[model samples]
Structure formats: C-alpha cells, structure tokens
Target: MKSFYIKIKSFFHSIEDNIAFYPALLSFLGFNFAMLMLYLEDKGISAFVIEHAPPLVINNADTAKTLLSFLTGGIISIMVFSFSMVMVLLNQASSNFSPRVLPGLISKRNHQYVLGMYLATILYNTFTLVGINPKETDKYQLPGFSVLIGIALTVLCFFSFLYFIHSISKSIQVNSILEGIYSKAKTRMIRLIEKEKKESPSFPDTSDWKEYGSKETGYLQTFAAANLINICKENDLQLKIIPIPGAFVLKEIPIIKASKAIDKELVEEILSNFNFAQGEIVDDNYALAFKQITEIGIKAMSPGINDPGTAINTIDYLTELFAIRLQKNDDTIITNEDKSLIYINTINFSELMYQVMVSYRTYCKHDMTCVQKLFIMIKYLLLQQTNNDHYHNSLISEAKYLYDDATANVENEEDKRRIEQLYKSLPNKRE
Candidate 1:
C-alpha cells in the first residue's frame, strides 16, 4: 500500500506541469457548480432574484440563449489564442535562453489558473445554456439566475485573458527566467541547510551488503525518503541508495544496497519508491539549477550568440546561489528518531565547484567581461561567512584556475592586469 502511494505521488509530481492539469481540474469543478446552479434554479432562485433585483435576472429565453452562445464562442477563441501565445513564448524562450527553463515556465501556477478559468467558464456556460428548455418556460422558469452567473463568469474570463497577456509579456525576458531558476534553487539549498543533521550518519560497511539493480532506465529524478525510512524500520534493515536525485540510472545498474540479502520481491518494492523520469527540477535537486545556469552562461558566450552581458548576469546569479549552497552540508543521511535508516550519496562542495567552474573556464575564458566576472564570482564566494574552511579552499582552487586560464589565453594586458589584481586580492592564498 505504501509503495503504491509513492508511485501515485511521483506520477502526479511528474505531470503537474501538463498543460491540461489545472484546466481539467477546474472543468470538473465547473460541472459540479453547474449542477449546484441547477439545484438553486429548482429552488426558485430566479423568482427570488426577480422579486428583489428584477434588473439582474435574465427573463427572456432568446436573450439568455444568444448571450450564452456568443460567450461560448468568444471564450473558445480566447482560450485558443492564449494557448498559442504560450507556445510562441515557450519557443522563443527555448531559442533565446535555455530549453531547461521551459518546465519552470510551463509550471507557473498563475498561468495555469487563468487557463483553468477559461476552461471552467466555457463548461459552465455550456451547461447553463443546455438547461434553457422551452417546456419549462411557463412556471418560475427560464433558469434566469443561471444565465446571469454565466455572464458573470464570461466577464471574469475576459479580465483573466488581459492578465495572461500582461504576464506572458514579462515572463519571456531573460532576467525573469534567471530569477525563476535562482529563486527555486536557492530555496532548495536553504532546505538542506535548515534540515536537522548535526551528527554525520555512519552507515554499516556495505562491502557485504547485497546490491540491487534498477529494473528500468531513466533519470532518477526524486525519491521517497520517508517511505524508504519506513520500509527499513519495518524490515529491520539498513539501506543505502547509491545515486542522488538527478542521476541517470540504467537497467541492471546497482542503485541500492541492503544490510542483508533481501529477496528480489522486497528489492522491487523498495525500488518502486524512486521516481525515474526526464527533466531536472530545481525543487527536487538544487544541483541541476547550478548546471542550468552555467549552461545558459556558456551558451551566451558562444561565438554565434556573443552576448557577454547575459553570461555576466548568469555568473552573478550563480555567485549568489553558490553562497547559499556553501552553508548546506554534503550529508545525505535520512534518520528516523535517533536511528539512521538510509544513506543517500550527495556531491560534495569541492566537486560541485569544479563542475561549474570548468564549464565557465572552457566557454567564457576568452571574453574579458566573463573572465573578470567569473574571477569576482569566486572571490565573492570566498568572502561569505561559513564555518567550513573546506568550502573556502575549494573556492580558492577555482579562483586560481580562473586566473591561470586568463593569464594564458586573455591577450589584452589591461584585462590580464585586472584579473591578476583580483587574483592577488584573494582572502586566502593557495600554497
């Protein structure tokens, strides 16, 4: 039962970004609302409206039918146009910025709510229009109040369409995309820092533990840590998840190990809790955010694009994100009460810095603006307060590597002088 819940949660998380998710949800709500209006109509809501506020009710069947028909057509047009605009912006963003950003953009809840509003309004009006029957027109009939609500919903959708127009305009800009990535990644890093893991969890020697292989292939995007802990405690076992989130898992690859040789059935049950899918979300894995930002900067520095301003901006964002990351421990221990139940591997700070810096050194090394910015980025990380000298040492190493790369490739003397000066101003010297 727990394993099934894990798969269900992961499936929803994977599809939250689907274009139809919110729209489909709101459409169902709209259907229920229509039924509610039908009940109110049966309860003489239209007659009550006619008694208190005659002007607000729609008495004429022809007028109500015409208005509902017109609204349904108008809303369908608006929905189609709004979706097309989204596709165009998505395409433009993919081309200009990074394709990695589309998931973030697609998952914007505000936009989805607006789309859902459009869908809901359409469904509501359609249903209300269907109830305007000829045979029931003699008594307290006409579904007058329902027609009024439909009109109200149509007007609201128009306003929502206007908001969508204003929003999509600003969303396609480069700074918005960078900030979106930076914000989520920073939040993720803060979670790691805030998570309680004072004592490093010591895992039992896994040399004798039985290794379990993945049954399928995909990127291991997320895992159910709580479920893994529960399963371990219930079975009286200590387990080690071999790969971190965002790792590409292959079929038959050793993805986990158990303290004792567990049967293949239990192994499959445990593996079911891991979510393997495409796309990297910063919320699930903060490291992917760093990689995405670096890729954008590198792409900006490409000879064809040649936008050093964007490269420099991306570098500045990375610098701030790295500062947040500095406070996070590399420990990936999941504990239950005082007992440690699972060990998940995580990339250490030194290795993370090298991975980010190597790409900048390779792509942006030739450009003076990028070279100086990369140097300052490293220097800035050096000055941030942290208890870990190891993180500082990694910064120092990356800083020197950047300096050497500039010294060898940066031909301009003035640029070289500035880098050398920044290099000399390092908070800690590399011996």
Candidate 2:
C-alpha cells in the first residue's frame, strides 16, 4: 500500500513537472468559466447586468459578434506566432547551448502562464461569439457582459504577449541561463542542508546484503526515500540503493542491496517506488545542474562554437556551485522519525569534482584562456577549504591535468609560459 501511494505521488509529480500541465489546467478552468457565463446569460443574468451596470457600446449582438470575431482571429494569429517564437528559441538554445538546458527553458512558469492566458482568451471569445443571438426577439441570449469580459481578457492577453516577448528574450541570454542554474542548485543545496540538520536515525550496516536488480533500463530520475524508509522500518530491513538519482541502470542490474533476503513479491513492491525516465531533470537531481553547466561550457569551447568567453563564464558559475556544494553534506541516507532504514550511495566530493572539471579540462585544454580560467577556479576552490585534504588533492589533480594539456597542446611559448605561471601560483603545485 505504501509503494502504491508512492507510485501515485510519483505519477502526479511527473505530471506537475511537465511544461504543459499548468497551462492545460488553466485552459480547462477558463473553458468552464466561459460555459458558466453563457449559462448565466441564458438565465437573463446579462439583462440585469446591462440594466444596472455601466452601458457598453458593444451591448448589441451584431457588435459583440464583430468584436469577438476580430478577437478570435487576432488571438489565433498571436498564439501561432508565439508558439513559433518559442520553437525558434528552443531550437537555438539546443543548438547553441547544451541540450540538457532545454528542460529548464521549457519549464518556465511565465511562458506557461502566457500560453495558458492565450488559450483561455481564445476559448472565452469563441464561447462568447457562439452565445450571441442575432435574432430580433432573442435579446436575453446576447451576452453583452460576457463580450465585455472577453474584450478585457483580450487586452490582458495582448499585454501578456508583450511580457512574454521580453521574458523570453531575457531568458535566452547565456548569463541568465547560467545564473538561473546556479541559483536553483544553490537553493537545492540549502534545502538539503536544512533537512540534514533535522534529527535523523543512525545509519545501518549493510555489509552482508542480498543484491536486488532492476527490471527495466533507464535513467533513475527519482525514488521515494521516505516511503522506502517506512517500508524498511516495517519489515525490519536495511536497504542500500546502489545508484544515485541520475544514474542509468539496466535490466537485471543490482540497483539495491538488502540486509536480509526478501521474497520476490516484496522486492517487486519495493522497486515500484523508483521512477525511471529517458532524460535528466535538474529539479529532482541537483547534480544534473553541474552536469548541465559543464556541458554548456564544453559546448561553448568546441571548435565549431569557439567561444572561450562563454566557457570562462560557465566556469565562474560552476565554481560558485561547487563551493556551495562543498559546504553541505552529500545526500546519501534516509530514515524514519526514529531509525535509519535506507542508505543511498552517492558520488563523493572527489568523484563529483572530477566529473565536473575533467570535461572542461578535456574539451577546453587547447584554449589557453579557458585553461587559465580553470586554474583560477581550482585555486579559488582550494582557498575556500580548511582541512579537507582529499578535496584539495582533487583540485590539485585537476590543475595537474590542465598543466599537462597546456604543455602538450599550446605551441606558443608565451601562452605556455602564461599557463605555467597560473599553475605555479596554485598552492599545492607538484614538483
């Protein structure tokens, strides 16, 4: 039953994460509102409104029809144009930036709200047009108030369209994208820290455990840790999940290991709480932010793009993110109110640093400026540390790799000398 509830929750979470979910919901509400207005018109509600409310020039059916018709046509054109612009933005972002960033761009709430407003306005105007009765005696059927409402909504949509344009234009800027990712990742890290401060159960020993494999193959997007903890507490078991949230697990591969051998039915039930999907979602997994930013930097440094400035900027944001992450404990355990039940194996600091920095070093090695920026990044990170020798070693290792790449690839003596100067400036340069 717990697993079933988790599945349901995961289902809704997936839906909520979708870009169109809120817009579709708003459109549905708008459609219902249009219907209610028409129903009120049928009951002579508009007549009372017309008599008591201020007079509208478009009170007549013919005028209402003309206005609604024009609005419908204009809104349709605006919607088409808006959608086309969105597609163009997505295409450009995917081509110019990393494809991983497409999810963040697609999930912008402002864009969704604008598109939903357009949909609502279109539905409201279409319904209002149909509600108008042109016959001489059908005075009560002409929804004057509804038509006025439609006009007001159309104006709001126009303004929203303008805002959408400004918002999208600003959003596409590379600096904005990098800052947005950094901000989100920082926020997630803070939340993790707060959660860790809360009283947690002791970590359980899982030395002697039976491995449980997955049934399907895909990127493990998320899992219900709390639910799994509850299940473990109830069954008196300790389960250690093998892969982190963003790992790709194949069928029959061990994804979890249990302290005691469990029945196949119970194992299947436990596995149901995990969600596997095709793409990485940064919202669910903060590590993906590092990956996404790294990809953007790599893409910027590619021969085709040849934009080392963007790569350097990406390094700046990455350095900030890494500094923030270093302050927080890695997410690797979960427990109930009283006892630890689930232990997740997460990427360690050294491995995560390598994963993030190695790509930049590999791709941007030939560019002296990028290499120098990387050295500065490592130097900054090393300064932020106090006694974490392992992390310092990792940073120094990265610097060494950068040094090796520069000496091998940079032909100009002056460029190589500059790189060597930066490398020597690092606190722990190898002899």
Candidate 3:
C-alpha cells in the first residue's frame, strides 16, 4: 500500500511538471467554452436563433423560444468571456506581478506565446458560439429569475476560476524547480568533466587545463572544487596526494614541528601510502614548509570573480603568512551540510560577480563595493550560511549608501539607523 501511494504521488508530480499538460490559457478558455455550450443546449436553447440575434440586444427576444435562446447565448458568452479574462489575469500574475509568483513560467517569449494562444482560443470559442446558433426556433424565453441566476453563476465561475489559478500558482513553486534543474544540470556537467579527467592521464602528462572564470563569485570555484573532488575520487587518490593539478606557490612557510613532520613521513613510508606530496618540513625556527603548501592550496582555491588576474592576485595573498587567516574556523566547518551550502554560496558569488561585471559595463558609475557586497550577501543566503559579522557589515555599508542617495527600498530613519549600526560593527576591509 505504501509503494502504491508513493507511485500515485510520483505520477501526480510528473503530471504537474509537464508544461504541455497545463495547456496554457487557451486550453482553459476552450474547455470553459465547451462547457458553456453544453449548459446552453441542456437548457433547451436553440443554437440557430442564438446565432442570428445580436448578442448585446437582450430585449429583442419576445417569444418564449427566442427569449430562452437569447438568455442561454448571452449567459454562455458572458461565462466564456468572464472565465477567459480571469485566466488572462491569473496568467499575467504567474508571469509577472511578483517575484513570489511563478516567474519561471513567464519569460517575455513565453508571455507572447501564451497571450496568442489565449486570444486564439477566445476567438475560436466566440466564432463557434456565433456560428452554431439557430436562425429560427420556437423558443420559450428564460424567465427573469432564470436569467438573473445565470448571470450570477457566470460571475461565480469567473471568480472561482481566478481563485483556482491563484491557488495553483502559490502551490507550484516554479522558480524553485527552475533553479534546482539548472543547479543539477551544472553539477552533472561538472561531474562529467571530472570523470573524463580521471579517465585521462595524470600529473606530468596533464591534459589541457581550461580556465573558467566569471564575475560571479561562486561560479567557477564551485565548479572547480566539485570537479576536483570527483577527479580525486575517481582516481582513488586523496587530495593530500595530489593537491590541485595546478597550484603555483609564491612563498614558503612553516607547517608543523620538525618532530611531528618526521614522524608523519616515517608512518607514511611504513604504511606504503604515498599520499603526502611533502610532509611538514621545519627548517628555520620561524616557519614550516607544509604550512606554506597548505597556504598555496587555499590560494589556488580562492575564486577570482570575473578575472583570472584577480584570482592570481588573491592566490598570491594566500601564501603561508595570510593563509592562516583563510583557514576555516572550526565553527565554520561544523557539518557536511555546511560544506554543501558553502559550495552553493560559492556558486552564487560567481554569478553575482558576473552580474556586477555586466552592471559595471552598463552603468560605469555604480559603486563596485556596494554591488559586490550585496551579491556577497546574496551568496551567503544561497549557501545557507550564517550572515556573519562580515556579511552583515558589508550589507549595512551598501544599504546606507543606497539609502543616503535616496535609492530603492530605503524609506525612513529607522532603516537608516539600523544600517548605520550594522556598518559600524562589521569589518570594512576584505581579506
């Protein structure tokens, strides 16, 4: 029974995701028109007279037959038109009105297609109703009470359709699905590339290394990290063994005590495990060698948003001295979930970097610092990471500048004060 229920749920979910099944606005209008036609015929209204009489003129039908015909025709038209208009509004809401709405459904291109389909459906229904009406039929006119009720029912249907559409739009979560699909596709592509790398030659005879960079913060880093993980796993190699395929070290630093480093190397040899590229080698009392390598690793990991040169410079800074600062605090790497979220954040940052680059090109005067920080916050949110003091500060600074300039969403004093306080506490400089 459980299995059957799961299958049923899955079936429904599949149906819901299928855009073709929804049939756009046109399909709903067509269905409503058909139903309206059925209702008219059931009420003993002759189609021939309905076709001959002008739709707007209600008083012309004197005979009972003519009146009944007119009443059904009018009601049907009203119902179909009413239903169609509600559908148009609902479709627009789904496509535009709010970010919370089904924005994924309504691209400008799709909007045009949907509008055209709806108009075609409306016209087809209108023509069908007009063409099928009777030229001459003895008609028992619908009484005033029946006509009034019909009009009320039409109004009810209009509102009812709108309500149903609104409910569906709320429940659908189109944007989430779109985002998830995009993420998954990109993830899979990264996996595929890593798989190829694993299947190919390793180290000395390395394959062509393609550079991926975008102004977006996390984009390239997330992809690179994921690929690296996959490659290591496929080759049955730990990261400690290979580190990154391409990491350039600008400086050296202390990693561990000489005694510990010597012991670690001895243990590796005894175990016949050659994972370590180099153990911590303590030379001068000042620094350790492996520490320098680790710092280099972190530098290699730093994603350069939108510029390779920027990335190279970031790596240069992550040398042993500053790399210590880059080390994830125990609090930062609390769980596997946290790591996964970080990866996502990294991806978002990359995208933001790209967006910032585009915005810079378009609007030369926009503040880079403000744009960068806003996107950095956006990345943090995407990653499901805590809005730590650093992010909060950056956001506050940006918000204040925007507010001061009478920018968007900065309305009053309370907001300004809040922004000021946040900026006051958060660090102004980035590592």
Best by TM-score: 1
What TM-score goes with each of the models?
Answer: 0.94, 0.92, 0.27
Candidate that beats the other on TM-score, 1 or 3, i.e. the better one: 1
Question: Which candidate has the top score in lDDT?
Answer: 1
State each model's C-alpha RMSD to the native. Answer: 1.9, 2.3, 19.6
lDDT of 1 by residue, 14-105 (tens): 77877689888999999899989998898989999998999998888888899999998999999999999999999988887789888889
List, residue by residue over 140-245, the lDDT tens digit for candidate 3. 3322222333344444444544554554454334333333223333444344434433333222211222211111111011122333333334343322211121
Q: Please give the CA lDDT of all the candidate structures.
A: 0.86, 0.83, 0.33
Ranking of all candidate structures by their TM-score, best first: 1, 2, 3
lDDT of 2 by residue, 57-133 (tens): 25577777887899888988998999999999989999999888988888888899999998988988888787777
Ranking by lDDT: 1, 2, 3
Worst 10-residue lDDT window for candidate 1 reads 195-204
Count clashing residue pairs per candidate.
Answer: 0, 0, 34
Cα error, residue 141 of model 3, in Å, equals: 10
